[model samples]
Target: MNEPSTIEKGGAEFEGVKLLLCENPLPPIDETIEAASDELPRSNHYTEPYSAPLRDLLGDRIGVSTEHIHINAGSELIRFA
Candidate 1:
């Protein structure tokens, strides 16, 4: 926990800013981003079973294999066991 620091709300900073611990912005780095508008497979089908390439990349990022990862759609309902 952080000691509540009072913010001056008069001169340059009219809006009082509250510092949070859970979030912090690091300096931006060079990275590749794929846009949805990019041309891709036209096959109107679900990536059945799983998408190996996506899983592979994800696993590599977190230092794990695809077998150790699980995926879920945001729209799909999940039940807590």
Candidate 2:
């Protein structure tokens, strides 16, 4: 797992800006495998369940349009336009 502190710092001349912090701990490998067992048959077409709510919250904040948000179940990559 990567550390939160590893997030790339912005420019040197810092301006006051709001920062949101989030931390998610992954389950053990065995647990993850067990949990995903049910989805193995359909994993190829899987998508993350929480993506919509998260996109709704993000809105256009990060240049991401809600309509372009796509999340994959087996991957951490989140694509947006």
What local distance difference test score does each model get? 0.58, 0.62
Please state the error at residue 71 of candidate 2 in Å: 1.6
Please give each candidate's TM-score: 0.35, 0.26
Candidate 1 global CA lDDT score: 0.58
Tens-digit per-residue lDDT, 16-73, candidate 1? 4465797555643434223333435544655544567878889999999788766644
Candidate 1: clashing pairs of residues: none
RMSD of each: 9.0, 12.1
Number of the top TM-score candidate:
1
Off by over 4 Å in 2: 1-50, 75-81
Error of 1 at 26 (Å): 21
The pairs that clash in candidate 2 are none
Our model 1 lands, by Cα RMSD against the true structure, at 9.0
